[model samples]
Target: MAPENTPVHIIQLIKEITGFIQKGSPITYLGCPLYIGRQRIIYYSDLVAKVMKKISGWQSKILSVGGRATLIKHVLQSISIHNMAAISPPKTTIQYMKRVIADFLWGWDKEKKKISLGILGNS
Candidate 1:
């Protein structure tokens, strides 16, 4: 691919990563420390951390190609757009369409099950 197109590809990857994080199923759930004894939050934080690490590793790789800073900037910009799209209405609706397409290409429950197993341990 052309050097200029690298930024666009990185942006698209960021968008995909954001959507995956926001809508992906919880990996684990534990009752709240207080409040309802059964309240739980998605264990997505770990997944996010892993993605960050991957990006950092990718950044190192990009540095060798001399596109490190530009790629990082583009990825961040795309993540901002994706974060907004994931929360708001019209954009969120569009993401749903994208998710449908992605699901068709990659099995619907594949990532969900993988993440769940990673977090919940073998039980």
Candidate 2:
């Protein structure tokens, strides 16, 4: 069973990933005249907000289901979206950024024996 509470490593990982992604394409506000000579990048807030909305909807659907395993299966099946979307945004894509962020924040990384330990307390 998944533990209750956010994980630290996952949080770190999320911060890292968010940093990496944002670094590659730093978003600039539209009509902002301060970047007249600079190249414009995609906005992180807009991308993140959209991704959050998609994940929120997905979580609601998962809750509607009765079984944890079913939720896991569905999530696994959609894992590709999570990884790919991080690198490239697609049209009408509902990537699983939330799950990735949540897992890194709360899930166990058994290989490294590193648990998030946000609320689980030194697993």
Candidate 3:
């Protein structure tokens, strides 16, 4: 990789320390992509793509509402929670995920009518 704009002192210090290569922008620290700017759209683009992929999958649409809810819970929560613990995701990203999950739980076209909680056997 070409030389980055990292400080000369830090670079020299890193050079002094063994096995410390400089890492540049747009790095993934712990499975979550870290960007320099605070643009939620770009930062969450890969995540959104993954969600859209899951939504477009045949298995995603075929599951019943309960099953879809279960699967979606797994999809939205797992990695996000871990990433959130490390890096605070923007509020918009959280809202966007909620929207994605809602759209997935129902049909994207949203043709399904509302039903009571009791009918779904939830208390």
Candidate 4:
């Protein structure tokens, strides 16, 4: 893709020669955002939503602590590995993912208790 100010005729000529379709910015390629300019949390917001959805889906079940930990280690971590390998996500995204995982692991609704960051790190 060309820059924003690139001439339309040039783009057409390139497309005609290369036979590659032109698409607008902010497109997703391989589950990652492909866009011009600086990277922002907006681009990775979907990743957070996806993790939240996956965790929230299992909230109805009465899972043991081991089951929850296993899900977090295998499923929740796997979802973000693909995107994380490609780009540096914002701090907020990482923090949100951690919070969701921790909440799911410790049974947030029933106990309504908090886990310290140190305990989380050891686990």
Best by TM-score: 4
Candidate no. 1 TM-score: 0.26
Stretches of candidate 3 exceeding 4 Å from the true structure: 4-24, 37-40, 58-61, 110-123
Native-referenced Cα lDDT, model 1: 0.38
| Per-residue lDDT of 54 in model 4 | 91
Query: What would the per-residue lDDT of candidate 3 be over residues 69-120, giving only the tens digit for each residue?
Result: 7776676566467777877767777778767666667666756664433322
Give the TM-score ranking, best first.
4, 3, 1, 2
lDDT of all predictions, in order shown?
A: 0.38, 0.41, 0.67, 0.79
| CA shift of 34, model 4, Å | 1.5
Error of 3 at 81 (Å): 1.7
Clashing pairs in 2: 7-105, 7-116, 8-116, 10-104, 10-105, 27-42
> All candidates' TM-scores?
0.26, 0.24, 0.62, 0.70
* Candidate 4 lDDT by residue in tens digits, 16-117: 999989776678888888878988878887788888889878963589877887888788888989998998788777887787788778767755676644
Instruction: Report the lDDT of model 4 for residue 47.
Output: 86
Task: Estimate the overall C-alpha local distance difference test score of candidate 3.
Answer: 0.67
Candidate 1 per-residue lDDT over residues 1-123, each given as its tens digit: 235656776766876887743233333223111222332322223323433554545525325322533443455334435434443324333344333323322334664632221111122
Model 4 has how many clashing residue pairs? 0
- Runs in model 2 lying further than 4 Å from the true structure: 1-42, 60-100, 103-123
